[model samples]
Target: MPLKKLTYLLLTCLFASLLTGAPAYGQRTKKTRAQLENEKKRNLEKIAETKKALENAQAQKEVTVGNIKAIKEQISSQEEQINLMEQDIDLIDMEMQDIVSAKEGLETKLQQLQKEYAAMLYSASKNSGKLNKLSFLFSASSFNELFMRYKYLQQYTENRKAQVIQMNKVAALLRERQSNLEGKRSDKKRILSAKVVETKNLEDLKTRQTAMVGELSKKETDLRTEIEASKRSVTRLDNLIANIVAREISRKNKERERLQDQEAKIAKNRPTKQPAKKSENLDGAETALGRSFGASRARLPWPVQRGFISDRFGVKEHPVLHGVLINNNGIDIQTPSNATVRAVYDGTVKDISEIPGLGKVVTIQHGEYFTVYANINQVFASVGQKIAAKETIGTAGVSSGATEINFQIWHNTERLNPESWLVPR
Candidate 1:
């Protein structure tokens, strides 16, 4: 029986250890509540931004295809917000479960401690008479036995005191765990309420998106006509860009030849036989500027502070028109009306012109590389003027009844995707 009791004790201790160890391990691996809350806050900010963009898009009197796109984007943001809220609710639920487990563990420990404390008190009560304790110590068989009895009494006294202290400690801990569990329950309730509201909002946004898409789908003919006009505008812009690039190239070549001829004349007047090195296509300042611009690839700032890419570069099927492809030389960013447009990098304003269908456009040169900002309502910088990165160069112009900017990056005559160059929105 003694052996069986010893085995049972060992098993009980092992079970308790595993129970306590599991939560400890989980606590080490799990994200804290603060971390989850911070992520949720950021997600809320993104939702707010998308809502603002949607409001701006709606402000336009005419309901164009862009308005539908804006609504779709707003719906996407609402869905993401709902997802984040769900994640937050899940985290709260996990926290509540953990709190419940902790409360249970504390209750178990407190019960065991109370039982041990009661047992100690009962044993002490049975030997409450001081005379009995003294006589029991004195009735030892030998001096050594008497000393052992005294030591045993002393140990017993200490054990009783320690048990009482441990009981109190466990009771306090159990109370703390109970309070924490209540708090967690309350938090779970609040999060669940929030989740319900967010889910409803998401559903409403989805319905609105469906309606917008449906309305736009009925105007396929008008959308197709708009697409055709946009295609023509893009073609005209491309032709103008090409002409500008050719002109710049021609002027650079002429400058290079002039420099080379001057160098040749100077070399002829020199008394040395060393040939002059070929003149560089760009001047020293321009070459340095180019190096700086090239080094900043994929790190350049957005042309507008607040916007989203409405159209991406390369070939894409028209959003509203079926069986139609639109080739985009640059990305189209949708922003608030009259949003300030800024330079992506430091450069000189090569030219500023108004294309018939493209609106006001400003082109800046960074050596061989050029960045063009189109669909500008107003130009702040002029031709041949030096501009710094993030400097306000113009205001975004309205297009298709929505504020939009067409941004392009070019290396000499070769057009590159502006999205690849600009920082992620």
Candidate 2:
């Protein structure tokens, strides 16, 4: 073959490989339509839940700081949903751009393939007549030349047929690309419409939040009085928990002494000098309960499945009262009205009592550790009744027009931060 023809063939092969071997660089990292839709669904669910909580908070005729706070939280959740929708819109836009670019590339490739096919057809037409083709073959100078002419004619016809096939393949690919681009453009339009609706909803929530805050701000004196009442309730709860812990410790100590006396009597009757193992004489059930509860720290289920911590454990500046510090031994979880309060762990109810400011309270004992659930309307578990983990103990009571439960954990006499022990919300 001529050097020029050999070089041309090599270049064509290289170009074909370049077109076929192109990497899909951004395909793996890009989020699919299903993934984006799933995220939007989750955000919508969250907004709905927040709305329900707000409705429950506003059920009472009188408005309180808790109600205002719930409205503010709902506003926050709506804002998050809007942000997520914005993200979805942005992703759709990016995907649309990519589709447009890919379609343009495919169109350009199709045009090139059509031009190549047309050129081949024009060359074939120029040598159209069979008489002209026969004369050209007869004009060869030698037998070898004639054979080369025949082979070249055969190869040329095959090349023209291959070019036509290539053109059809490119046309099909171009059509597919166009279809995909249109679909993406449609998706972008829908996403933009959804975003507009979400944006309007977000604005409405903000307006409501502002109104709630303004209403609460005008009642500063009433808010201060409520805070004082809450402080008194917290104090009474602390005292009650302390007394309960003391009584429980004393009871456990007496039981330990009795067990020791019984072991001693058995040992005295034994004929062997070897001492009995502690595990053989001690109550395994009592010891195991404490160990199991302790082992479940940071893994314990929430007392209420759906709620937010309105008041966290430890001392902090009051939300409404300036210069006032409120100390919390346990977290205050605010939930929808009539929400069922469940036990965090398996235990026996130790006491059921009512304090001056707070409502009904239930204390459960898991060996050495104790759990307290307060601000409840009705109790389902009585004193000395065995309770299972996540079993409903009572219905949450409304306080200041909002349902809030005070949850606490104690190991013997030491009070623990319930937030640290409970699973993250």
Best candidate (score: lDDT): 1
Q: lDDT at 56 for candidate 2?
A: 67
Number of backbone-clashing residue pairs for each candidate, in the order shown:
0, 0
- Candidate 2 stretches with Cα past 4 Å from truth are 1-43, 56-61, 89-193, 246-269, 272-278, 281-283, 290-328, 367-369, 409-425
What TM-score do all the candidates reach, one by one? 0.67, 0.65
Best by TM-score: 1
Q: Candidate 1, which ten residues in sequence have the lowest lDDT sum?
A: 2-11
Against the reference, the lDDT scores of all candidates come to 0.76, 0.75
lDDT of 2 by residue, 284-345 (tens): 68779999999998999989877876667898876555587878788877886689999999
Tell me the tens digit of each residue's lDDT in model 1 across 333-363. 8887779999999999988988866899899
Candidate 1's TM-score: 0.67
